[model samples]
Target: MSASPPSPGLAPRPAHDATWRRDAHTIGLVGLAHGTSHFFHLLLPPLFPWLIRDFGFSYAQLGLLVSVFFAVSGVGQALAGFVVDRIGARPVLFAALGCFALAALAGATAQGYGGLALASALAGLGNASFHPVDFTILNKRVSTPRLGHAFSVHGISGNLGWAAAPLFLTGLTHASGSWRIALAGAAAWAVLVIAVLTSQRAAIADRAPGEHGPAHHAAARGEHPLAFLKLPSVWLCFSFFFFSTCALAAIQSFAAPALHTLYALPLEVASLVVSGYMLTGAAGMVVGGFLVARVTRLERIISTALVASALVLLTVGQQWWPATAAGAGTAALVLTALAGLGTGLAGPSRDMLIKQAAPPGATGRVYGTVYSGLDLGFAVSAPLFGALLDHHQPAGVFGGAALALLLGVACAALVGVGVAARRRAA
Candidate 1:
């Protein structure tokens, strides 16, 4: 029997869609785009074993690629914010994705280190603008009350991206017997995401005809372009990113390799530990989204969570575990994954605190400036930890990471106090 067409009154009406529906659509699209950018962050690192085998590269040489990538990105990201504010985010978004596709292709076809470096630079260029673009669109387009959940989704999607890269890259290589093919696959992913974003461009657009009020305010005030750089809380946020991501870069670059050395686990198995860490971290972001709604003091949440993660990393660094490698490996991986969960708990509060720090109408600039600290942290830490790995000190990666997290805790505390003072003064 042919199904009868629904009566007009019974049909689902798009006009009457709930507010949450529209917010969900915007949030979902932004999360997907954010996740894709993060997926490229690990594009080269996960292939280190393959690159080392093919090119006879040292840990320092390989680590330099990461340093180069972030160094380029840190400078460009600060500038990308101005472009985003001037030109609009949608076009820049398309361009960023295109660069990722090109980066992946460059990696796929590389014959040596220079080719790999070119790929890294291209990916850095792609990454340079995402935070500015993302936060601008979210703040402008999404409804206010849903913003906290949007940040949570953003953080969770990023962790998922970080988790997916190693498994995707290594699994493809092992299955297909070619690393080039794996990179080609990443290129295809970038292309697909670009197409998706282009189709939904209107929802994320910031430079639309009527959206010039914020830009006009800056011009009217005749404020210096670098004016936002003077805020104490802004630099404290930068310090927060710098120290925190030093710990993150350590894990991203060395965690799997360190696990392999210390535990006698195969590289493939050790890679799963990083994946586990990220997965559990994503889970933590879920609970944190709710936790931030109840907490008055964001710094306390940030402090407690990071301190816990630092302790776990410290424990692994101290090698306080069973005498047997098997027992120790199992225990260490569990502890590391737990640490990620604790860090994940800090994600929503971190964004909320940053939101509190931003002055009126300067979201893009403040986020761009502060987030450059993240790039700086990664650029400086990768080589330093690479030296530890070269010197046969697997545990220093975790210990150094713990120390960096402690620095981050101090910065977060300062930022929280500063924000509270500003509120009272206002």
Candidate 2:
């Protein structure tokens, strides 16, 4: 016999529907904040050429400017996680946004390199809080089944922020004939975003998991602040991020010029090619979001993607194939996009791996410490590759990036093994 239809009263909303709605709202707000962080990340790099002309700075000096930004961000991020754990993510998030706005304003009105350096340092201070704040909220608030997609949305938003920066800043500068005006406009945009986020603060505010019970009690009893350093998995995760981000740093800081040198492409075309990589990487994140839910072996997913990405980078670095000029240009763009897609697919899996490795009650600290590796990688890449460019070794940038990815593959494998060993022991 057929089952009877449920009565209207009994047929009320499924629990998951409400849960999904909450997840959507939470992810949306967090993603917006994350995107703003990334948008500011590129605020200076795209204008490097202009800065060179205007400031009379050497390539290495300009690279040092970026290095200082991420170096400060790296140290502050690890510390900010502890703050998020202690004070909650909401206030820290607000403070970060305020810092970003101030940084932009400082940059806009700056008269010299000293002022710009100060602005970059302030921006780094702002940038430091985002990963800790974002992951703490997501882990605490989002339901389990939908977390993969939440991470995907988060990653995609960041990539979109990266993609948007050049278009917005460069277009404004071209139209206004003043980079400072473009920066001031960015500052204004940050304030508007801050206002919008403040209005929705209640929905996204969340204490780090386990904040009110054992962890807090333990802290009250004088638990060591560096207790998290005992976890082997944390260091492994940190290494993964450090090596993986080297590839990203190369793309963000050098891709346009690298393509131009390799393929004889114009600046506009090279910039477009870099933009394509970011957009396609965002699309790849969408695909990975779906894959993460279904794929049981997250490590294999991450490993395979990084390996493919490395091969693509190696191919481009070698400058092989595509004998004709037209073919070479086409090859460069295609390879870059493919490499982006591969890494994009890995993004959600990487986040999931970190989530799995995090200890109870310490998500904020773990994410903060591990993600600081990205800042360290970014800090190192600028001066390292800037020197290459200074010496007329454009190919070395991509080659070094490819090497980083290969090393990243090893790191991913080691992390997987480390997690597995810990689990088996447990």
Candidate 3:
């Protein structure tokens, strides 16, 4: 049966006839887009073993590859947002998907470090465009009340992708006995997502026009894109997110290994613990979405959360008794979970605040710029923590992360002040 198109002035219907079916399909589309992007992009940590064994790349070279992926993306997102504002989400998304597809194909065929680096950069470039476009679309199409849940759901989809990528690549390569073949399979998934996106493009386009008002407000608010650079609130948000994500990336990328080194836990057990942290994070995101609306003082909520996260994380590294290992593990899990939950809770408010702070019509640029701070956090954290782990105990890394979170708390408090000032001025 032919699916009916979405009603005019509404968000695009996923090429499905029934409303429920269409909503499911749209969600799936968003999920798949995020899934594939994260799946491909995050393949690095696991692929390290493969690359080291197969190509004899040093730790330094591998580090460079990972850094390039995120660094390019840091800049690329701004460009993507600009492109999104000018060309609209449909075209920009397709373009990003296309870049992803090509990058995947290239990654599968890479013969050397240089080849892999090129492929990674291309994939990062492609992955960069998804968020601004997806978030904008969801804010417009999904009901406002449900937006938090929608964001959380979308976030979980990405987290799921993150959790699964290493295992999937491991299983695929082991089964096929060929890393290239496994990577090729990954590339094929990207191709399929692109095709799905293409088939549904008209439907998505028809759903609703992009956010013209905020986009315009964004531009008007800042005569130049760099105008927000001087704003304390803008930089404050940047600093807050930067540190929050630094701790997050440390946990995401290195916590398990750090635990393994500290305790005698098997790699498998440590892996499970990390997975627990991430899985719980999905739940946190959903819950956080709900809490964001209920909470009266967002700044206080943010500040309190940051302080709590710092305290919990710092506890993981403290001196204790014989059961210290077990206790530390439990503490790490709890602290990381709290941190993740707080991050989820503040996610929407953070973005909305950034939009609010932005000069009118510059939402894309403002978000893009602030988002670079996020990238800055991750890109810097992974290596810095790695170095700390190499020299000091795993506890030192956690301690450092705690300090960073404290910094974030301070930044969030400053944003609160700015919010109050903006209200009075208005």
In candidate 3, which residue ranges exceed 4 Å CA deviation?
1-28, 57-60, 206-230, 319-339
Tell me which of candidates 1 and 3 scores higher on lDDT.
1
The TM-score of predicted model 1 comes to: 0.95
Instruction: Please provide TM-scores, in order, for all candidate models, with all chains considered together.
Output: 0.95, 0.94, 0.83
User: RMSD in angstroms, all models?
Assistant: 4.5, 2.7, 6.0
How far residue 2's Cα lies from its native spot in candidate 3, in Å, is 38
How do the residues 1-426 of candidate 3 rate in per-residue lDDT, one tens digit apiece? 999986675655553346555555666677677777777666566566677898997644665676777788878886777766655667777777778767767777888988788877987788777776776566545555555566667777776777677677767887998777777777777788888888877545513554454545556655554565688887788788788878776776666666666654465556554455556656666666676677645677667666776776666656343434456555554455555655555555555555557665555556666676767787777777766666657776667777887888788788877877887899
Candidate 2 local Cα displacement, residue 270, angstroms: 0.7
Candidate 1 yields a Cα-based lDDT of 0.88
Q: RMSD in angstroms, candidate 3?
A: 6.0
- Model 2 spans with C-alpha error above 4 angstroms: 1-14, 208-217, 220-223, 322-324
Candidate 1 error regions (>4 Å): 1-17, 323-326
* Native RMSD of candidate 1 (Å): 4.5
